[model samples]
Target: MRRKSVVDTLREIRLLSELDDGEIAVVEKNCRWKTYGASEQIIDQHSDSNDIFFVVSGRVRVVNYSLLGREITFDDLEPGGHFGELAAIDGLPRSASVMALEEARIASLPSDQFQRMILSHPKIALKLMKHLAYLVRTSTLRIMDLSTLGANNRVHADLLSLARKVTKDDMTAVIQPIPVHSDVASRVSTTRETVARVMSDLARKGIVERQKDALVVKDLERLEDMVEDVRGE
Candidate 1:
């Protein structure tokens, strides 16, 4: 694609939408595009590469390995999502690995360029700070969940988080492209068998139903209640 098309694509990204046309043009001229196949590692944990990556197509996962070699998934990101900003901003090694969950296209900006953009653009800097604060808040919550919540509650919380509200009149929601049991287990720091059992119990309780492509949440309020009950315990 031409440079202008690339600029337009970048403009669509929420983080970059605030940039003026001249700034966007500069980014378009400086950024490099790269593609990775499914299961390919885009960035390794503790690596020193300080380039920020923006997902332009497909999906990627942020993962980290425990000392015992267990893999934990932090998040799944899709188009318009970006990662590696933390390292790029802080000048630290990557805290986790990033892998392409499917064939993916990414736009890469060198650390120097990213820093320059943030320094020159007050809105961009503000957005970056907000994004980092969000990451910190999310990490704190995850730590709390891991330390205090039971396995079942963790699974419930994970499912509820993955669900998106589907209707205005009712509490119906859906997790389209519902993740596999093993992936959910990884996220919740549990085994697949436990996740499967908890999911089965939820189904039996009529809280959620499994469909071919998604897990339909019958009552989002009930799911929220479940999490609150666990918190109260």
Candidate 2:
């Protein structure tokens, strides 16, 4: 890709979205671009790497493996998203492994350069702080779900969190790109068979409808109530 195009892509990232062309040019100059094939490892958990990664194209998943070798997915990031900021900010080892879900393009900036960018740009630093805060909250919520909720409830919560809000005539919402059962299982720390069973039960009860590309919550209120019921139990 052309240098100008690379700069433009960097500008589109939320962390750098507000940067002026001159600032973006500076970032573009410091970044190193790399591509990975499908299912390739981008970063290993606990590895010492001070560079932060920004996804330019395609998808990647943040994951960790259990002692027994089970894979737990933390998040799926697409273009305009980023990872490794935690390590970059604190100079620690990676908290989780990153893998390309498909062919992907990434831009990496060394920790020192990233720190300089943040120090020179207060707004960017504030954005990074806020993003880190959000990640912390998400992690806390996941821990709570795992500790207090059953596998079935965890599945419900996971799907609800992934769903997009929409209003059709009234205010109805649906989750597009309904995740595969195996993916849901990984996120919820359950077996795929359990996810499939819970999904089937929800479908039979008319709480949710599974379509080709999406999952429609026929009764949003009921679904929410179900989640609450699980939480209270």
Q: Which 10-residue window in model 1 sums to the lowest lDDT?
A: 1-10
Candidate 2: worst 10 consecutive residues by lDDT?
Answer: 163-172
lDDT of 2 by residue, 142-230 (tens): 89889988899999887766653453533346777777999999999999999999999989998888888878878777777788787
Q: RMSD, model 1, all Cα superposed?
A: 2.7
Prediction 1 TM-score vs. true: 0.90
Indicate the residue-level lDDT of 16 in model 1.
86
- 1-233 per-residue lDDT for model 1 (tens digits): 56533433576567888888787778877988888999999999967899999888879999999999888998889787899998888898899999999988888999999999889888989988898898899889889999999999999988877774354545888777776999999999999999999999999999999999988889788988999887763
- TM-score of each candidate structure, all chains considered together: 0.90, 0.90
Q: Candidate 2: which stretches are off by over 4 Å?
A: 1-8, 165-172
Residue 155's lDDT in candidate 1: 97
